[model samples]
Target: MTKPSIVFLHGSGTNADIFRLQTRKLAALLQPHFTLLYPDAPYPSGPGPGVLPFFEGCDPFATWMDDSSAAAEDAYWSLEDDDSGAARLLESVERLVREEGGGGELVGVVGFSMGAKVGMEVVRRLEGREDAGGGGVKVVVCVCGTVPYRGGGDVAREEGGRRMLGRGVVRVQSVHLMGETDPWRAEGEKLVGYFGEEGRKVMWFKGGHHMPAEDAVNKQVARIMLAACGKV
Candidate 1:
């Protein structure tokens, strides 16, 4: 029996090695039920508007999309045509399936902040090509997830996002965990809207812009993901 693999995407300024606090805990439980594949972002974190882009003191922190825009500092983002974020990320994902001999069944992806954007992008990009195989990422768990933006207005209606919404690759179902006090809470809500009325859920936690790191929170997070993947 092939063990279904679950991909874990780290946030901005963070790498696959640093599974965030919550992911570190959830990974413990996930070990028994699924294969966990963690992939680092392609580029090291760079100067963002004003938010010193390094995770703690970690060196070479990576990021998916470089937000080199003048719009709202932290709100505007653009992917260089040369280093497309989705393409780079999928490279890591596909590499894992082929080299590691895993992902015989891809159950889901749980991403945090910037990592969430990477995961979502993968889902959007693979929208119409599941026939090629290993592109079936239908379950998504967003922890402090940031909406993927490009110059302007959430681009779910165009390109990859359009295919995702149209259920081209898979009928993506999502579970979003947002912090009540997080400044990006509203943005997360807006992302939920993109998923439409059904097969989507948002849960509020008491904290700032971070995922729950406590054991209890980790359990609930795992439960939600397992349920979404129909593994529970």
Candidate 2:
């Protein structure tokens, strides 16, 4: 049987290899139920938050969009293009699916940090395109992510000192894993507000701007993802 597929999108300044290492444990738990796809971002970027010391050798990092010197929330306003990473990301997944020999059944997207923003963008585009194939995306898992933003005047309106959804609200089943102490925690929460109430789940992990490391947390996260993917 062909297992449902989930694309694993790494944070900015980190390649697919680094993301694979970060999620190795969680990947092990979900391996039987899902075919995970990890693709590098289209653009090269500097090292993200804590990617230096340990992952130094994992060079040639990438980003879905260009690196920003502005604050995280304000960064999207200056993006070179509105599509940014989503367009290329979708293309990469489609190529991977073809390479999977019909084994890739894309049902959901899981992204971290900037990758989370890219994931949401993919969901938005998929919802708009009636021709989007592969059973259509069913759910999205955002880990320490933020709201979607497209540059060059694509409905990125500001309200209450935060960017509101300009295109439309995403109604897909979604899961958000937030870091309790993450500097971007507030941004993550704002991202949740963009999704409809139904089929949405928010989880808080005990860390700062990174995936959960504890075995128990990892198990629970995997369970939630499986459940979201209708595997549980």
Winning model by lDDT: 2
Q: Per-residue CA lDDT of candidate 2, range 41-96, in tens?
A: 87788898999988988889998775243333354433235553455566677788
Error of 2 at 54 (Å): 1.3
Structural similarity to truth (TM-score) of each candidate: 0.76, 0.83
C-alpha RMSD between model 2 and the true structure = 4.2
TM-score: which candidate is best?
2
lDDT of 1 by residue, 50-157 (tens): 234334555566776665343522332223232554566676787785666353666688888777766776776565356665366657888877765532344532
Per-model clash counts, in order, read: 0, 0
Q: Judged by lDDT against the true structure, how good is candidate 1? A: 0.66
Clashes of 2: 0
* Local distance difference test, each candidate: 0.66, 0.76
Clashing pairs in 1: none
